[model samples]
Target: MKRSSFFSVSLAIAGAAALAVAVTAPASAATPSAATPDTSGVYSVHPIVEKAGLSTSAVTPSLTPAQCLAQTAGRVACQTPDSIRAAYDIPATINGVPAGTGQTVVIVDAFGSPTVQSDLAAFSGAFGLPTPNLTVYYPGGKPTWTGKKTQTGWAEETSLDVQWAHAVAPGANIALVVAANDRGATIDNAIKYAVDNKLGNVLSMSFGEADNLIKSPNANNGQTAQGVKALAQGAAQGMSLFASSGDSGSDNGAGFANYAFPASDLNVTSVGGTNLWAGSGLNQPRETVWGDFANCPLTCAFGVVGETGGAPSLFTSKQGSDVAYNASVYTGVLTYLGFLGGANNGLYFFGGTSAGSPQWAALTADTIQAVGHTVGNVGQQAQSWASKGLLYDVTVGSNTTPTFSGGYSATAGWDRPTGWGTPDVNGIIAALK
Candidate 1:
């Protein structure tokens, strides 16, 4: 049976759960701004109303480090012990979920961040995050990136994943699994390594090549299959894998549910993006939803202006997403890129579903704390969204693809882009058991 969508799928949580309070920045040699500020600091971006309308509140506005730390408590996890990134948010202790402390989260990425320690520390410091559960290693101890163009990009991507996951689940230990290359096999093996070793209770991956996640073998077979199976094995071992659905939207590769590698493995969770929003309640709330207009017909240029929804995939298995969180621009994280050479670059601004993937991973840690169990069977667990109050109903937005199928417009119910809507962290905790 080819399940067409994840909309009507359902599931259940067996007990009571709750989340503990939880919880970036800047500079450049750069130019004068006609705008009020350059916004190259993590603390500057306003809280989002929605990430492609997937969640109602993604960003937490500007909070002092003390406040963020006070909120998360033991869950103030981080890849680095930096101060800049900590001010944004880092729960002091990931005490809510049933997993308790000492659990681990494996962050899988394409390359290495030599300065991961320093950058993460800065990220933590700025956001007021607690020190990470620690223990990081490049797969084989030294991954061979070959210094590809994408290496640096994925490096920053890696930093974001580990730093944020730690911030949200400070009490949880983090194991970063890196690969020699981004193309194939090696990365897959890294996933397996995490699984085989019982490295963590949750796995968060941000790299993908934009392919049908489950159906295709991608470029590297044996290794790829090993990775997929590893993730599945991890799931069976009581771990949840959070894979980033790509930032390109439906237009990625062939468009519509075009998952990249592990995200589409069917065995793991294929997390998509949504326009994240935030504010007091609802009406007239300060919000920012997901949008990425690919170049096409009426519009010759692709940009962040029109694609409010997100990419979709009819190819993905039912309940593919499980749930979605903020992963868009406008409500982006500000930081100093410096001038190249890794974290020292003049300045940098990061957004995309990459940020949301780990945030969800960390939240799941909290859910585990509250539920007393690490979430397995992501598809089944995510289905809990249908339980009502489990998620913030995403009621708007759309993915602007050059050739979008169906109506593709965002509406009141579940659609391709923002599946099952955003996580009601508190509600999820309450429902955990």
Candidate 2:
């Protein structure tokens, strides 16, 4: 997610205090910025890693919410695939067959991860998920990686996108579409390639820029417009699209009602973030808008102030987020990545709207399998599902940050922060049929 100049200054001050705390910890502990790449270009984009790098020496399989809180000293709560499925009422099988079979999920990212296949295999083996038929395609040609922050950061994004999508729909095939670079034309053209080739039933884009930047004549150069065209083409072909609303809150750090493009586009389903409270064998899970001030638990400890990007679009009348999922750094999801090399390889907790995109794509695959056909627009179906109580309505919390005081709040039905709240997966499947 992109940040404005004023928000950067605040993060810098908070980051300084956070560095002091890290000085007394293990030398291998990485700061939030170091672990998560900040690829904030006007046209290009980056993944949203709400927390810093907390890698283990070996694969730790999965961590319970209580275990994560204990391990992180009450700083964070984590969830596994099983817990997420239970919280959302996701089924492992449908009609006595593995769910999401005979469907495909296409995940698009820039600078594909080097060890995504091996890492995904490890993650699946650890969690007992079936190994998906995975394929990596480079329409713009394979990118070279010298282990730069730009490439490595995107690599981490690829890992998270691939791993979690499979976690939600293990029986589905996965296609990882790699854009050559983070340039405006390259990434947008990659979406065109995926659409032209008829990649899959769902397309997941976990990147975006500020709507103000996208609308700027000097900044965007019609990049987002081209992306919208591609997405529209895909939708016409019966594809469901999902993109991250953003992690910088409604104003997008611009001190105004700024939104993120691609997500703000009408053809795409915009996914927002939430602070999910589940696990410990709870019958029902609770959630709130993913807005962290200086008072949040683990986020405050690391000086990370994140909120789900939402609000009315600057370009159009569309709301930024149509649905939401778990995205708070305080209650993040676990992901495994060993391609970073050295001590930076292992399990790490990640948060942000970026995490929600691919998982929603997995849900799309599940819906496709359940209905025996593609659900043309997930947002439209979800909007209709809202009245049927197929979604969890989140009426509490706001996306206000210190930088943007006028951020929108989560409302009764469909507001900015969390659109229709998080998914009730089983209910949605039943409604789809």
Candidate 3:
């Protein structure tokens, strides 16, 4: 979703029938800077907290929408326990159940983060959540990558997804199957890697690119049908694949497009984005809503980003963004990105359906643990009325901006950007039956 000096072709985003709406943008919105990592700490802001009830402490800070782009660009990296609680309606004291000692959830992503283990500890400790079954599987960390800068975006995302899911569903065994890079054959290999190793039941993927040309093995397309067939055999063994629909929408981030991969695969669950409003300690009836943003067209100053380029999906619709959670920059968790220019140890905000997908995966673990069942092929049940109603059905608000042609507005019924809304922990557990 790069934004530095940009321009985008005005796509009519015709006849998706299910989701076309009029587009809008701020009056004075400048063509956003190519949306990239915030080397400047403008987006490095956090909620002001204290040893007290909700105050200015819980008050979410503000940054221009342009400054917020980096948060979702990588992977939804700042997913903290509190965000999960509001987004899921899981009780404050999730220690009610035993740690997920036997169940399993495997996270597949690019690269690895150095502080994954310690960060897990801090997140779990702060909220009194259970410590989940956790392990890492990289086979090798790619002796080539040191995991610096651009690599950091995807690497940190991988760490946050694996750890947060494990923390929320502590009793579940969590394994991380790592890939060497964010592009090329590496990601495909990572997915196959997880499948080959028999990492069955509940798998998660948080990134990818698009291949608009009719499928070609060398063109970075999805698993070949034969490959998909083999994966289906794995799914028959009760394995479920979950992937982020990508930061870009249906147009493939060339402004308003969506990317491919496991997300595009019919056999997998495609998680989407949402803007959620949670009352940290408000204690009133909390309300949940859908969140999706529109992208701006490309401009010469900031060219269409490679990751954000490529054509629309060749594959037709699948059931995903089968579900969603808070992936917007404003309602996201806050953390500290490494300080730049030896300035303040910069604090920042981050979230994307990247954060939400793993959150859903972890909730599945908790439900599996609670009900003691491993109902695979969750994609079907996920869209059922039982599951849909169990979810929060985030129904308010919509993304309005000039850059994007495809509108991500929330209508009365289901929307493209966020499928069946987010999960309602208690209701989701009940719906599992």
Residue range 327-373, candidate 1, lDDT tens digits: 54333443322113632332123456666677777777767776677
Each candidate's number of clashing pairs is: 108, 0, 43
Specify the highest-lDDT model's number. 2
Best by TM-score: 2
Per-residue alpha-carbon lDDT of model 2 for 315-375, expressed as tens digits? Answer: 7667768999998766777788787677556666677788899999998788789888888
Q: What's the lDDT for residue 290 in model 3?
A: 28
- Worst lDDT 10-window in candidate 2: 4-13
List residue ranges in candidate 2 displaced over 4 A.
3-63, 216-220, 280-285
| TM-scores for candidates 1 onward, in order | 0.69, 0.86, 0.69
Q: Report the backbone clash tally of model 1.
A: 108
TM-score of 2: 0.86
Off by over 4 Å in 3: 1-83, 91-96, 140-145, 211-231, 255-259, 280-313, 334-348, 386-388, 399-404
lDDT of 3: 0.49
Query: CA lDDT of each candidate?
Result: 0.49, 0.74, 0.49
